[model samples]
Target chain A: GESVGLHLPTLSVQEGDNSIINCAYSNSASDYFIWYKQESGKGPQFIIDIRSNMDKRQGQRVTVLLNKTVKHLSLQIAATQPGDSAVYFCAETRMSGGGADGLTFGKGTHLIIQP
Target chain B: DAMVIQNPRYQVTQFGKPVTLSCSQTLNHNVMYWYQQKSSQAPKLLFHYYDKDFNNEADTPDNFQSRRPNTSFCFLDIRSPGLGDAAMYLCATSRGGLAGPRGFFGPGTRLTVL
Candidate 1:
């Protein structure tokens, strides 16, 4: 909650290199974690998600790792491209009463792709 | 094919004036949410509508109100805009339940308070 309107930390990676963005969530009760890529002037786009039962999940070019023990989540981007330049947010949610709950987001990391 | 569309990608309103932002989803998601995102910051959920049930975040300002007349469309109204209210307003939808699908977000509307 302290992250409101705060300047995001940045991670700069050379183009075609792999980039890893890390987030440390606050709630241990959070069971669902997601990574979102938000380009300038656009809304947040869902990248990859992993549930608590599994420690790892892979998407097309992205992989999400969850560590419930440390309440940590990370996103690994392979062959980072210029288009991949954006702000990355790691969000956690607690599913209760079998329904949707609001997501609590991290301060976020701005991933910059260098030529 | 556009799944979720938000009108007036850029909106300019005078302070103390009432303005409304709109969102419609073709994904037919059961839950729709409105979020306020400031520059270079994470989004904060204002409220959400699960089907016909309206749920407002406790901290959401009383000036902010939402209406989900039907399943596909939702509206966010600001009674009196202030300079601090200027930010990107995002509309998101999800298939809510035990399965809890990832939310689909629309191209946010950037509101500029004059």
Candidate 2:
């Protein structure tokens, strides 16, 4: 994925409501997918990851769902809070008989929490 | 306890001048990567080092280069900075052979070109 600057899509949800951020990946052979959250002025922090063989994986208060048929991935926050407001990015990579190579990231979504 | 450390959280350089951003890791992972991220955009992979071997992305500009002296440190050098080169530079490390779900990232260095 290329970096197309500015005007990121925004998702606004009331506090305590569940927030779902969606991403459409480019490659069908990508066997690994991960979600990252970036706060203002900070680098992306890894949230959760799932492999192609699994359709869903859950972490503390967060869940990742992958649909390989449509090449779509979604991150769901169980109970949203102001602290959860950040830019969410979904990254994909394929281990094609090589080392764990660089990740290709999708255009991020800016998650905004409402009061 | 920061696993990945990036020096000079902010950098300012003049157009056409050289600038270097540094990253160091304590985890001793064999794979380290550099990514360039502009505001409101996703990070684009610049290059990576596995142990001492360097691999650069095909589309990464010739002006951008990276060096890894050892397993612990990596440097990104921009020989001639353009206004478009200004962005947040992120460093990451992962255990080389796996899917790298545990890749740890640094706090990033934001570059400003005048």
Candidate 3:
């Protein structure tokens, strides 16, 4: 992934309603993508992941959709709650950047769950 | 339960002093990563160790370093802490390099430079 500036976009949703966070990745060859949720004063927690071979993967109330054709990814959360308010980041790993290195993260999207 | 643990949940160090943050995992994963995140910023990869092999990010400053003595332990060493270096240090581990489940992250060590 190409280096990006520090600014990030934000999405606000009402509590008990569904929320959708979107991301646009730079690398088309990225084969693996993961979504992470980082709450206040905590490390980024893994939410879900999707491989390039597949278009969508679901886990619990979270679903990751990958659109390789547009080099885009989105995470949909069901029944957003106050606990879901946090910074969400999407990371991508490609076979090209070297061998099995760590992921390259996006600028992140702040998910605000409003009551 | 399988989880990642980080020691010294809070650290305070004087400018130019050396500081180390520790991380350990019970999942027995082979890969470990260290990241630095400022307030409201994305976690930036500083470096990682695949077993004993150390891989550093190209843009990572010379002031930062890391060590993974074994499969479950990894450490981040700041040779000379600066005010700008003060941030939350996160440690993560994964079962495999790629095509693996979401990597597990430690609770993070919040570092404050005096």
- What interface Cα RMSD is found for model 2? 1.8
Write candidate 1's Cα lDDT for B1-114 as tens digits.
758899999999999999999999998889999999998778988989989988898899999999999999999999999999999999999888976847789999999999
Number of the predicted model whose DockQ against the real structure is largest = 1
A-chain TM-score of every model = 0.91, 0.90, 0.89
Where in model 1 is the C-alpha error above 4 Å? A1-8
Compared with the true structure, the alpha-carbon lDDT of candidate 3 equals: 0.85
Question: Which sections of candidate 2 miss by over 4 Å?
Answer: A1-8, B99-102
Better of 2 and 3 by TM-score: 2
Task: Report fnat in order of the candidates.
Answer: 0.58, 0.67, 0.53
For residues A73-102, could you state the per-residue lDDT of candidate 2 as single tens digits?
889999999999999888888766264588
What is the overall TM-score of model 1 with all chains considered together?
A: 0.95
Compared with the true structure, all predictions reach lDDT values of 0.87, 0.87, 0.85
Candidate 1 chain A: worst 10 consecutive residues by lDDT?
Answer: A1-10
User: Measured by TM-score, how close is model 2 to the native structure?
Assistant: 0.94
lDDT of 3 by residue, A17-115 (tens): 998888888777678888998888988888988888999999998999988887888899999989999988999876443335677788888888888
For every candidate, C-alpha RMSD to the true structure in Å = 2.0, 2.3, 2.2
